[model samples]
Target: MISVEGVAIDTRHWIGGRRVASDRTFADISPIDESFLGDIAAGTAAEVDAAVAAAREAFPAWAALSAPERGAILRRVADGIDERREDLARVETRDNGSLLRSHRRGVMPRVAMNFRFFADYAEKLAHPDMEIRGHRERVTYDPAGVTAIITPWNAPLMLATWRIGPALAAGNTVVLKPPEWAPLTASLLADIAHEAGLPAGVFNVVQGIGAEAGAALSKHPGINRLSFTGSVPTAGVIAAAAAPTIVPLSFELGGKSPLLVFDDCDLDLAVDLAVEQFDNAGQVCLGAFRILVQESIAAEFQARVVEKARGLVQGDPRDEKTDVSALVSRAHLDRVSGFVDRALADGARAILGGAAPEKGLYYPPTILADAKPGSEILTEEVFGPVLTFQTFADEDEGVRMANDTRFGLAATLVTGSPEKAERVSARLNAGTVWVNCFFVRDLGAPFGGNGKSGIGREGGTYSFDFYCDVKNTVFSPNGWKESSHG
Candidate 1:
């Protein structure tokens, strides 16, 4: 049995609800210490084909069940997750280098919540009825056949379930292609679903690199819908591959989200929110890493932020007191450090950390200020514990600076005036605008991106729209009379 942190897992492809081993395997290494975790099954086109075939064969039976029946099974899955929350948390922290406390307290719990929320939502789903030209029109949703889901490495279990919950709740069978960097929890999830009484082939996981299992799943003609959460370049590749079959796609890509700090706002709150970008070692796609402060309070805000960055406890993720941890891998660390290095070379100032740690995959909490406009660091996503600081002269400039990016995933506004919050939020180009807050997610609200950040939204009914086929039937007012057959 493959194990991490005492949590024994079956590191193989789960096809037709059974453990299916692959011909090849890859090393699963820990970023915390570069320790070898285990060998995970490396999937290719063959595994993807098998999983997709399984999903297609199981679709009719799964979709034939009543929505409430499907939801009941999802609730059981949620219960299973809750029962193993601690074990799962430990395994995830060991596998991904995320803080143990965060996994135990937030990420694992949210994974369970995702299942429960979607389970309830699927049961309570109601479509609007309309009368058009004296005809009664009723809208209904039917489960799209097989769904192909590709998830990222940063928060593997949580992000996968964010899509998986809704897909299963909507009565569609799924074939998940989890990121190779953190594929352990996904294998564990397959076991949980099987224990929760999900039927064979209803949910499957194929583990491997993006070019093999991921690409095969994306281009599979058998898939009815595809949902991907990752980078923009990967999204483009997946989109291009799926274009031939014209499969419906839902994408939640990367972001360079902004947090605007105004002169009239609470300084402490602003600083606290700024420091929050480093959460998960700044691997968060929705993180407001680009901080645009008003010129009046720029000096004070920058100083306090730098001071707090210096004081953050960085070491073992297993430690409860540790506030930051390692990047997912050395390549990611190099990528992040490369962005900062280029920024510094281009005349940007590093107020805090600018160097990679002497050992381990830890890149210090870095802040780069005064990067020239249109620079790569500001335009592209570093996806690290790095922040870019700039000052805006006025509200117009603040809004403009925040909106001046190809990414519009999310934005944050800090102000004492409710009117300013309302007015500025309206003008902001982001899909979600947080007022005096960050990373507050409500399942009912739509979540995704605006431009290249993403293609569609997730959560509540928005998810159903992608996982199910919405159709309308029109009834003639005088089409039939009672007891006409008799």
Candidate 2:
């Protein structure tokens, strides 16, 4: 419905320093009502080349800036995004099907906070120790030249900004390839960065399928580092593509995380936390997908969760009181529906929701009971608002079941006893574990999984490290150091 600079922008690509339009552009339909949003231009190899070339050209100067200068610019960028928070939130809601209330209130603010966090940590990040063991020696940090940041669709702008913002603060020129499914806000983010006085080519966004544009960005020799946030299978492709170049890579992959509910925890409190953990239909990587209920209170816990889950009203995200919204697209809904069907055939009982609303792209919030560990519902990252439950015989068994999956992003533990909470928290293999709570994330904490769930850490100081390379600068006081070479 809206056009910018005469180009029809859907969730399309912005390569190099220009917006691209293609005849082969694809439609962007809002999942809320199955209405056609607009069309996005597919990016080509040439565009990728141009983006990388521009990044390459901009790298030296961007990298060479003093740490304070970079930090100041990053602060300005954060302020700019904060100024346009409401507009950014609307674009995100249109692009990702999240609630406007949550987008404007929760998502956009967190993104701005991330930028400010990076700005605050920028100077501290570059501080290197002076070594005087036997001679005057010191070390410094250096930018990794051009970085390729590939983001996902779930939390489009927020997730990508976590990578792009800090990467820029760390002084790396970036060629961003946002998910084709959710690309609009990334383009908007690029516009904001430009408007905030970021040099052209210092940051760029290209919209295209991961198979085409994403692969090209990863494989390009000019890019010294690649930061990716998506599923594991896709991460494999990116890893393979970047292999020849052997660039440093940061990957935050899939998660089939667990949440353990103990008998000591208030049943009502546990139920509320479990439902909220899946916030926007459980599509997030850190979603507590598997619920491992303690043996003593399994029945009571399941009953409370089912009651809460049953009350959810699934419809368009725009509705003021809609607790849940549609999946990203029909294709995604079909995939989720197929998973539910397979789970049922495998003998999993659907207690809450198992089908999509017939009228629109609305997929109901679902909860499955007694699903086996090997079943599709339990094993794979279903990525829908589906909760799979299993009863545990004891505390040890619950911890074992929680760590069974290959993914380990986060886990939520509900228990009243302090000692028990500590024991279980220690046993959880996930990067983040919440005791008596769920979805407790702070901007300063380091968050990422230990197992197949991820490769690198992100958040506050950790995010800055991913985008930079530490250089050892040894200062020899005696004129010049002797070389071992003949």
> Each model's TM-score?
0.99, 0.93
Candidate 1 lDDT over 1-486, as tens digits, reads 686888899988999979999999989999999899999999999999999999999999999999889989999999999999998999889888999999999999999999999999999898879998899999888999999999999999999999999999998999999989999999889999999999999999999999988999999999999999999999999999999999999999999999999999999999999999999999999999999999999999999999988999999999999999999998998899899989999999999899988889988899999899999999999999999999999999999999999999999999999999999999999989999998887997999999999999888999999999999999898859798995
RMSD of 2: 3.4
- Model 2 residue 456 distance off true place after TM-score fit, in angstroms: 1.7
When summed lDDT is taken over every stretch of 10 residues in candidate 1, the lowest stretch is 477-486
All candidates: CA RMSD in angstroms?
A: 1.0, 3.4
lDDT of every predicted structure (CA atoms): 0.93, 0.80
**lDDT (tens digit, per residue) of candidate 2 on 276-394:** 85578767788887888888888888888888887877666666687787688888888888999999888889888787667776777888887866777887888888888898888
Give the C-alpha lDDT of model 2. Answer: 0.80
Q: What's each prediction's clash count?
A: 0, 1
Query: In model 2, where is the ten-residue run with the lowest total lDDT?
Result: 1-10
**Which portions of model 1 miss their true places by more than 4 Å?**
none
